[model samples]
Structure formats: C-alpha cells, structure tokens
Target: MTKPLISTERVQSSTGPMVIASVLNSPSERTSAPHRHARGQLLGARRGLLTVAAADHHWVVPATHAVWIPPDCVHGLRSHGPFHGWSVYVAAPACVDLPGQPCIIAISGLLREAVDRAATWGEGPMDQRQERIAQLLLDEIAVLPAEPLGLPLPLDPRLRRISQALADDLADNRSLAEWAQWAGLSGRTLARRFVSETGFSFSQWRQRARLLRALELLAADVPVTTIALQLGYDNVSAFIAMFRRALGVTPGRYFIAAS
Candidate 1:
C-alpha cells in the first residue's frame, strides 16, 4: 500500500517553522490525493520517478528534476516504485518571490545537498545557522531553470475529452480526422483548437503524452520492447528513435544516468 511520507497535519499547520524539510526512503509505492497546503514545496526523488498532477497539467519528474508547487496549489503525487526523495516546504509568507505556477526544475547538486542538511533539523523553528542554510535553499530554488517536463491540458470540454482518452490509452492510434469525427469536431477545428488551447498540435500532444507514459513505465523496470509495443509503436527502433529525439538518450541510458 502507498504511504504518506510526512505528517500532513504538521505540514499544513500554520504554526510551524518558516521552512520544514523531510526525507523518504521507502520500498513501497507512495501516493497522495489532490490537496493543497499553506506552503510552497520543492519535491524531488533521488532514485525514482514521480508523477505530479494538478488540475490543468501533469508533470513527470525523474531524479534529475523536481517539481515546484506554489503555496495553495492543488496537486497530487504518485511514485513509480520504491522512492528515495526529499521535500522542502516554505511557509506561504516566504513564497512571494517563488514561481507563481508549478513547474519542473532541474535539480542541482548544491540544492540536493542543502535539502539533505535541512531535513535533519526537524519541524521546529530554525536556529541561526539553519536559517542561513534555509536562505541558501530559497536562493537555489529562485534561480534553477525550469525544464520542459510538463504536459498542459486543454480547457475546452471537447479537447479535454480527447486528452483524457489519449491519457487513458497511449496506444490508441486513431488519426486526427477520426478523433475529430468522434468528438463531433471538424479536423481543422480540432487542429487549430489543440494548438491554441494547449500550445501543441494534436500530433505533438499525442507524442508528448506517449513519451511521458514511457518514462513512467521505464521507471517501473518494464522492458523496452514491451513498452514500445504497448505505446503503439510498430517497432522498437521507432520508439527508441522517438525517445532519443525527445530526451537525447535511449530509455536504458536515461535511467542509468539518473542513477
């Protein structure tokens, strides 16, 4: 069964320290329901993949990346398998300069080491030296570059239906014309609306959706051939090519580099 990594009550309480940090090193799967708290969060895994879902987008975070959740932003999380991660929570009052929207940021060694040091301080108010470290954490967060690891969902009901269907089954190989007909939209309308609403063409969106799922499955140690076939690729080489094009590495090397 999935487990909570930290005390929800403690993290949500308004009376705690300005910054609270926690670490999770678990063999079991972990998940959290969609919920919002009063703190901005920097969440990353060191040995697994995490999928974070907000109301309008999905993010696939590998070990080299972390998701920044602004204070009070509703989100949920699921780990692919055993997870080793750290989370740094900043009180809402301290979040004014943080990113206004949730995003995936590249994790630097300095940020990871600093968070590890802070995780030992417990939930109490920081001492002077700890306060200085906390400031370093905040400074690192402010400057880390955001990555292209998010999938934006469409607001239009018709496009949402299409997106949900694709998410449910990335292997579905229906063409745009067929999907438009099924959704009661013209092909041109579907193409144009997809670009405007999600900033991606229908083909681009579908490819991205498949890539994200591939990452999730790969994290679970699924075989490349199985994942390629499951994701609607006719041949393993095609899938590998696509994966390399998007991530600059093959599936195997990707996880190896992360490790």
Candidate 2:
C-alpha cells in the first residue's frame, strides 16, 4: 500500500467529453473514500493493477485492461505498483452509447494510443484538434471488448468479515472449521449461513478470493510459480489450472490476448 503518486480528485475536471489522462505511480493500499464523477468515465491503466469496488461488484484492471464506470456511481480504488493511466470523461448527455454499469474492458493498441495522446488534456479548454481527438477516443473505447473478471461482493456482515479476512492475507489456507472457530460459530451454522447470505459456499468463496488475489499479483507481473506458492496453490500448474478455469485461458495467454 505505497501512497499513490496521483489521486483521482486531482483530475476530476473534465469538460465536454474530454479524455483526461494521468500517470499514477504506486498508489496507497486503499482510496481515502468512495467518490463519484459528474460524467461517465473509462479508467485504463497503462501499467500495474487497478481495482475498483462499487456496490456489490468488484473489478480488477490488469495492465492491458480498462474499466468503464457510469456517471454518479460511487466507487473506490486500490492500486498496485507504478500505474500509468487515463480517464476519459464524457458528458452525461454524451454517455448514451457507454456501458450502463461497471465493466472491465480490453484495450487494443489503437485505443491505447488514443488515450496516450489525450492524457495531456487538463482543465483548460480543448482546441479543435483536441476536440477531434476526444471524439475519436470515445469511438475507440466504444468498440473494446469486455472481460468478465468481476468478483461479486456480498453485503451480509458475516460474509463481509470472511471477505475482509481474505483480503488482508491472500496466503491464508486455514481450514473451514478453523475459520468458523475464529468467527465463534458452529461449523454447521457457518456453512449454512455462508451460502444463504452470499449464494456461495465457504469453499467456493475461498476459491473466488484466491482467484481475485491472483489477478492482483498477476497484474504486478509476478512470476506464475511465485504467484502459485503465494496464493497457497500446490504448484504452478495447479495455479494455472485454476486461473484457466475461471478466465477460460492460461495466465500468459490471457495477458497476451488482452494486450
């Protein structure tokens, strides 16, 4: 959780569908609080991992991916490593073609160049050339494909506690009985309530937690073998198998395709 070199609040100014790009060097472990934007935004990181949490949905943005956030959706971010990124903001009226909800998008070379060219835009008025670039940026973003890599968070307090515990230590591989004991609940009650509240059993929830954590580590470009050991998988192949099961592609192929 190194302090973020750049803050979102530092670049909230956007006029007439502007693509405001910013470079964030390793951000703090957590955002100060949830914040909103007057206009819809597509936040893309040129490097590092960017995680966005809003309502029950949590999105993890790998270096080659971007996130589309609807206007007025209160969200927070947690960034890892030196993050170079862009925030393309569109006036609400201009957001008709944008995604209606939060989404993780794949960024192509063309879109990346468009964003890089527009990152220089500040609060100052855009000239005709800049205006044209903004329009083109929006057009490029509209065609990018979305990746279903989001982890849904549950609201129940008990389920929330489990999520928080896993977030603090991705390496934890404690037994379910031990976890329940720490929570001071009988195993049966814990097991039953887990599914009732989160619609996922404890084991399933743990797998998801590990899956999400793997993404952050992968975004940092950690070696797959190291990531496997760190996430409590027995070996590299095991980790790759799990990742493939969830994402439908091996880790290396996933990034290659995404990039």
Top candidate by lDDT: 1
- Candidate 2 at 162: error in angstroms? 2.4
TM-score of each: 0.67, 0.76
Across residues 210-230, which tens digit of lDDT does each residue of candidate 1 receive?
887787678668899999998
In candidate 2, residue 103 scores what lDDT?
Answer: 83
Stretches of candidate 1 above 4 Å error?
1-14, 21-37, 43-65, 72-88, 93-97, 107-140, 219-221, 255-259
lDDT of every predicted structure (CA atoms): 0.83, 0.68
Error of 2 at 153 (Å): 1.2
Per-residue alpha-carbon lDDT of candidate 2 for residues 1-259, written as tens digits (9 for 90 to 100): 3343334553343443355555443433435267776677777665545666764576545565678888888877765444555566677666778778788876767777777777666666789998888788778767776676554555656656666676556678888888878877778887888787666788887777677667656767888899889878888898898889988998877667655
Give model 1's TM-score versus the native structure: 0.67
What is candidate 1's CA lDDT for residue 250?
A: 98
